[model samples]
Target: MKVTLERNHLLKSLSHVHRVVERRNTYPILANVLFKASDDHVELRATDLDIEVTESVPAMVSTPGATTVPAHTLYEIVRKLSDGAEVRLETDGGENMVLTSGRSRFNLACLNPDSFPDLKSGAFAHEFDIAAASLRELIERTQFAISNEETRYYLNGIYFHAVQNSASGSLFRAVATDGHRMARAEIAAPAGAEGMGGIIVPKKTVGEVQKLLDGVDGDVHVEVSDTKIRVTVGPVVLLSKLIEGTFPDYDRVTPKNNDKQMLVDKAGFAIAVDRVSTIASDRGGKAVKLSASNGLLELSVTNPDHGTASEEVAVDFETDGFEIGFNARYLLDIITQIRTESAVFLFNDANSPTLVKEEGSEANALYVLMPMRV
Candidate 1:
């Protein structure tokens, strides 16, 4: 097989697909990427048994054939090559594949393409198109809250499903939680995605899909089945297996009647939380106290070994005095997700979960944070 492609094209395609290849594989072929050249294009495919990524790039194919080569090795070589250089790859039915660029040449061991495992995708039960920007926002707003705990496998990923919103009618919602905090984001559901069931997308898959959607405009095609989910963005296709465990009922955790409202500058509140957390004790647990009452908000943290710190910020609070303790890191996480200038916090009491929302926006996103003992 022989093909010639521009250095930039090959490098970009490799970067998109090679991330799926594992560094250490029980099967030798699993560590390599399958390259096939035919019909004026080259296809690159990589998989780690559970997830697969395939990308196609325009190339000049002099000979039509296929082979497998080390994914990282090839990527590094192409990355170091001079810009605008033409890269030539050829293998004449031999164990070694020849790579040639301007003033450079290298031979890499090749594996039989037949040895690569097939990533079978069954019939898609639902297919819809969503704006790339909206999809990316959904992932970014909720992915940070996904749990890293392995014991409760259900909390390790984002849960996606269709729901009815009173203000916006049909909506596609994404929710993630790790017991300490929970994040939820919604976008208008596409026309064809009415009765789709909920699916738990693994954290790794959500990250990869986020990368593909970065800086991308227009619509992305999404296909989902019972066991797998597939996303198509332009010339790239990403497939991932769904988490087998069921996600917990997140609605029950959200506070229904938190009427104590405290509105503060989002940026200022985030800065105050960060500043007080500096004096918090990592060994004793990083905790910060939030005391809010009519137009005043005070943040305080104390560590017996270290020192104590507090900061007062102005807010638009009219409710009676209320104080709450929470993990500093958790408060910062939810604050960062607020895109507006003001962050609105609703509290029932010191121990109840607090509800956060972006002030003055039609965007349907909410965050629930569980308070901790001081």
Candidate 2:
């Protein structure tokens, strides 16, 4: 196989697919990337058993063949090559492949391409096209809340499903929770997405999808089945297995009747929480106490080993006075995602979950944060 392509094209394609190959692999071939050159382009594919990422870049193919090479090594070599330089990959059906660029030449060991595994994307029951920006928002807004706990594997990814209502037509929603906090985002359901069953996309696959969606302005095609999901973005394609466990009904835990409403400046509240939590203990959940009454909101943190810190920020709270404690990191995570100038917080009591929403984006993105004892 002999293929020549520009360094930039090869590097970009490699960057998109190489991340799918994990650093530690049980099989040697799994650590390598499969390259197939034919006609006017070369296809690069990498997989880590659970997810597969493939991208094709334009190239000049003198000889059409396929081979596998160390993914990370080739990526690093192409990344260091001079800009606009021509890259040549040649393999003479042997155990080694040669990479040549300007004055740099390196020989890398090649693995049998036939031995590489393929995540057979059989058939999809539901398929739809969604704008890249809308898809990106659905993933980015809720990814932070995905649970890392392995025992309750259902919460490890965002739950995607379509909802139909007479009042609003069809809407697609993404929900993620780690038992302590939950993030939910929704958009108008793209055509062909109605009545689709919920699917739990693994966390790693969600992250990779988000990365590929970056800077993409065109529409992305999504195919979903009972066990797998396939996403096509331009010349790149990704296939991932869906988590088998069922996600809990998050609506039951979502607070609905929280009567007390407090609206605070998003930036100011975030800064105050950050400053006061500085002295909180780092070992456990960094608890920050919020004391809201009248028109003054005081944030404080107390640590027996360290010291104490406090800050006050004015807020709009008309209900009865109350005090609540929450994890500082969780608060900051939700606050950073708010899009409006002021964040609305609905509270029932110090023991109940707090519902947070941005002014105009309340329906599109909502966050539920569980309180912590200070």
TM-scores of the candidates are 0.98, 0.98
Kindly report which residue pairs in candidate 1 clash with one another.
none
Off by over 4 Å in 2: none
Q: Write the residue-wise lDDT of candidate 2 on 34-120 in tens digits.
A: 999999999999999999999999999999999999999999999999999999999999999999998999999999999999999
**Candidate whose lDDT is highest:** 2
Q: Give Cα distance to truth, residue 361, candidate 2, Å.
A: 7.2
Q: For candidate 2, what is the TM-score? A: 0.98
RMSD of 2: 1.1
Model 1 bad stretches (over 4 Å): none
Lowest lDDT sum, 10 consecutive residues, model 2, at: 357-366
lDDT of each: 0.92, 0.94
